[model samples]
Target chain A: MANTQVDQNQVLPEYGPVTPADIRRAAWRHNLTLQWSWNYERMQALGFMWSILPILQRISRTKEELIANMQRHMNFYNTNPAVGSPIIFGAACALEEKGQGEVADSLKIALMGPFAGIGDTIQAILLRPIVAVLAASLAMEGSWAGPLIMFLFGLAWFALKFPQVTWGYKQGVNLVTTVAGGALDKVTEAATIMGLIVVGGFIPSIMARVTTPIKYVREVTVDGQLTEKVVELQPALDSILPYMIPIVIVGFAYWLLKARRQSPIKALLWLTVLAFACSYLGIL
Target chain B: MTYGIGIALLLGIIAYVAVVMNLGASCFWHEALIVGAVTGLIVGNVELGLMIGATLTLMSLGMWTYGGATIPDFMTGAILGTAFGALPGVGVEGGLAIAVPAALLMTQLDVLGRAITTLFIHGADKAVAEGNVRAVTWWHLLGQLPWGLTRFFPVFLAIWLGAEPVQNFINWMPEHIMKAMRVTGAVLPALGFALLLTMMPLKKYWPFALLGYILFAYLNVPMIGIALTAVAVGILYINLKEVRARG
Candidate 1:
């Protein structure tokens, strides 16, 4: 995250100061359409440009300067909207205010990838799955706590907007130095550990609940009297190891995804076919 | 007529909000759980909505749109699924049958939405060349149109066109086929969990995963219980590592 090209001790020339009001305005729009304009060509360029327009407007003296700066930002820009984008927005604001627009552009291009990794790990992998699964489990049980939990968790994201922006604004490029020190990695490590454990729990409790419907029955005459016998495969397998079939199925799917490199769509189609065939055969 | 139209309109609004106003952390509003719950509330069947939504959530576990990738639009699927399933004799599995494939198909619309927004990006590009800052912002704002429309139209038309045809389609489904669909629903979640496992650092953390599996399978510890224990272990792991670093 640390770039040697950026001299840490270089004193910035003071220009139009980016006000708190400008930051607040930018933060408000952060939630609005940050990814709505995501295109294959430039990704989040339009939305990212739109979000920090207020800050750029306030910091630039001449109309020409503002347009030029906006055009610079409109270049290929994409990152996780929550954690990554805000820091970049703040850093951009800080640099634009000092009229160091070229450095800002280069830094945005450089840092977007790493921040995206961090943000995706945090938001997509850990938080969304854990919270949504927790809430979904509750929802499955017919508790109103499902939506209530989701709504409450959403507020935490909303609350993060202000401080994240403020921190980015305050730290500017120094934020990269802090990230380079490996703190974000620690956070990612913890999250991965927690996510693995939680999702591991989900494998058996949720996915492995798909029980087999197979059963075998027999009748025999013993000592001149009729006797009946019953053998249930699901319970038999469960007694040996609970959720054996489900776990095997999940493991196979994992092999397909990782070993075979099958697309999720293809895997899904095949699974649907297999499920129907197995059901027709009374295997599940 | 009005009853159907009102619910359709509400769902359309929700669809628009879910996709456009991602709100930083994406707010998980686009997740099936929230969408399904909201749809359930609108269609006067929150419990059914949540149940179907949960199923879809599990089915969509590791399916995230990272770095401009488009996954299935189960959020919209949940809305239509819940609304149609809420009808008499439709049932949850019937909803699942329609919703699952519909969602997979909806990925194209998501791609289209992104492409449509590229037009707005070009609009912004033109505005930038002309030095009209306000116009650039306007182009950015107008980009929301395709995103909103892509989600809204499917939800609105599916509900507005009403559920008679859908219900008939479900009713006409053979008993064994319905049974197979139910089985498919049950087994498909394995793919989701597997996807999560693949995405995770399972090789490094297999021990914790085993701990979780054992706790759930043998001891019957609940999910929250396992989560709490994991949190404690995580903190302990981090602290121990820090101590080692200092030494």
Candidate 2:
């Protein structure tokens, strides 16, 4: 069925005996509830099994085979839902259709870790911050664009799940090399740099109000006459550094969270207490 | 308020269910910004909701639930906080007082929900053993109960029973305590930035961060301006690295 007129890249690999409709059903399930039944013991094992149950039911001739496949997918599994699950599921689907159940299991185990790393970095750590921060900045300003932007960004990612799964099925194991290459690394690195910059800017702007309200009154002799002068601590601190208070606060928090290895809850509580004391003492 | 108690209650449950199910994208509805806005819209104050959501968004930044480890349930916090903030005198500062601590406490509930859902997973396992596909599907879908209820109960309770008490508590506060709450709210975003810094490779990228700060603080550049500059710098750095590698 090789047509010379068709582009090689566009052609999907024959998925053995399974109909295209079956893959679509599996894709829809994966897209919808990849993390619905998330648990401590198996993470996304239940969701994973359920998403691919369509394929398992279709490919298995006997009830035992279906049960075995279901049980196998129920093993501990976790990854970035957007990118990782689709690829693993796609490859697993291909392998299952070909009656290589053992190979599919091993493939799922091996790919989950690396794919999680890449998927989390790209989707969660990188793009998420950028989009979320931007949307938040807008939201903070009381603009309708805030939620609209976030909703759109999320919808775009949701839409990607389908094509990504389809591509995974088409490429199968071959998709690994394409993703793990240097290009992904470069993209991730660039995103990291951008994220750092955005966060840095946010520190000064978001915490602009956390300034000292203390003022000092001093008497000075000017041409043999007594003159009174008023000086504010906030202006003085701003002269030294625009956001010195904010910088110190962020620095202290970073130290508490990183160097001290304290839980974020502790850090937040400490900050709240410190703020209360500072306000009470009139030092803030 | 735009929406009544009934509508707010319904929206809260839907928000929880949508997020837990990962219906659209993973953690899409879970982010504070979206949740805050939704809560705000329900309460007839989208603006206040967005503001609180923005603040909580920063607080929840970099606090992803990677590897099944539970983080604070700020999404729920955003809902309750926005609802509280939308009250007559509670405002954004008062919202923070409740939202910050409530988020931390909700971590325990998060653990409880996960634990309960583990029972459902075990049920799914049993269904699998019996070769009962329908049973397995039911068990898996049933896990949504714990996840959604953990959020629904608090949000619904807050809107139903907690509102009057919260308003009374705010009215009872002295001036200095209220000011302290405002100060606390102002300073809390720093904790969010700090947490994010811990997750980032700040040591290697300190200069860019410094540059961002200087551009915003000293030059009075806007966020979008700083962001554009960052992109330029990133491109420059990447190109330089590529050249060095080639050499």
Candidate 3:
């Protein structure tokens, strides 16, 4: 009795026909679990899904085939936890309708990085930040709008994901290829632009903080003027001064790590020790 | 129970689940949203959760795992810090300030989780070699547990026990200290970017990096414009060079 119930529960409800809605639902479910962080693994899983479409297509010839394909698609989440899962699944779905093996696989692999990059950039950098800011802005106003923000954001994410998945299934791998010529490239380019802009804007705000222990000596004169002078321990070496330590450290470390194949950790440890010693002796 | 307590519990559960699923390291948005919502729900102000989550997410925008070396486990800090932030008087900005240090400490926990999970990978390898799919699957699933738990338990426990105290602490913090925290919060993203830049092989692409910096910095060009110009210039340069060579 328990076994029978378990078997019955395993059977998902047949939604009249395997329409775009069905595909969308499947994709949303898959996306929720895909987790943007483990994208490479997710793509691999997608690759497996792509790989199995031919077999499913051969086994069925009609609407029933669609149902079977959907089932097969759902089964993928249980199998692989690799990066190309969604791509593979979408490719397989495409192949089920029309058998194009090598072309599909090639396309899937080619598009995987670009797709992942776009998805990650938009989801991570753009939408997430915008939503958070909006919500926080609302909260700052002391309105009871915080909970609403979460629900709305979740809905929006689901909305964005579902259509992409459904479209991938309905259009098949050719969807990416067809869209690739103009639309997809534009989208990717746009995303890349946004990412670059944000990261670029962060440069001065971020990187201009390289510090050194060396300091200039300033003599205070009675006329209320300050004369700056270098307090170099070795006055003869002053000409090659400012860049000497940096050049030596960078060159020596680069050679040791790149040429000699010393591990980075070991190189870093030795460098840190040398730096500390040099600093202690005021010779850095 | 008050909405605050209920929401705290919910956020704790979300934190637990996120860690368990190992989703914390994967999707900053998902983890942040979920934790934020839960905290918001408990606090009777979901908006505050969203704000805290969003700010924390931005702060961790560049945070990522490269070949399994995860830095500053943003998941824990975001969740717990948001929970603290969502408290009646503890504001999102203040919450972010607290979360930054919390995230720094959480890094150790994340590293420990990764180390533990790596051992499970070895076990899964053994299972695979033995032709035991069931064992392999089990090992794989089991391996995820430590990472998940590491993500979940600490934030849950910390928030559950320390939310009120954290609020008090926040209240007591001097204005300068808060300013410093906010400054540090803003600065950390740059550190993350620096870390990323350091890891990149920029020698061949040095021109791109320099162009990107100049376009953003001096030219004040938007990223989109820079990317378009860069691509066009790059293509033109290559074609022109080819023409010259052939001529």
- The DockQ for candidate 3, computed on C-alphas, is 0.14
- Judging by TM-score, tell me the better candidate of 1 and 3: 1
Q: Which portions of model 3 show Cα errors greater than 4 Å?
A: A1-29, A35-88, A96-105, A170-284, B1-11, B19-34, B40-75, B82-97, B111-144, B159-247
Clashing pairs in 1: none
lDDT of 3 by residue, A75-147 (tens): 1121122233354455545644444433343343234333444454565466656665666556555444643
Candidate 3 interface RMSD (Å) = 12.1
What fraction of the native alpha-carbon contacts across the interface, defined at 8 angstroms, is recovered by model 3?
0.08
Query: What TM-score fits each model?
Result: 0.61, 0.60, 0.46
> What C-alpha lDDT does candidate 3 achieve relative to the native structure?
0.47
For every prediction, compared with the true complex, DockQ reads 0.30, 0.30, 0.14
Considering chain A alone, report the TM-score of candidate 3 relative to the true chain A.
0.39
Which residue window of length 10 is worst by lDDT in model 3 chain B? B183-192
Best by lDDT: 2
Q: Model 2, range A1-284, lDDT digits (tens) per residue?
A: 21246444543232136777888888887888777787644567788889888878876555555677788787656677887788778877776765556556655644564466578678767888898899988888889798789878888888888888877787754533355556545645665677667667767876787799999999999999999999899989999989899899889988997889986557767887898899999988
Estimate every model's Cα lDDT from 0 to 1. Answer: 0.72, 0.74, 0.47
Give the Cα RMSD of candidate 3.
12.8
Cα deviation of A241, candidate 3, in Å: 26
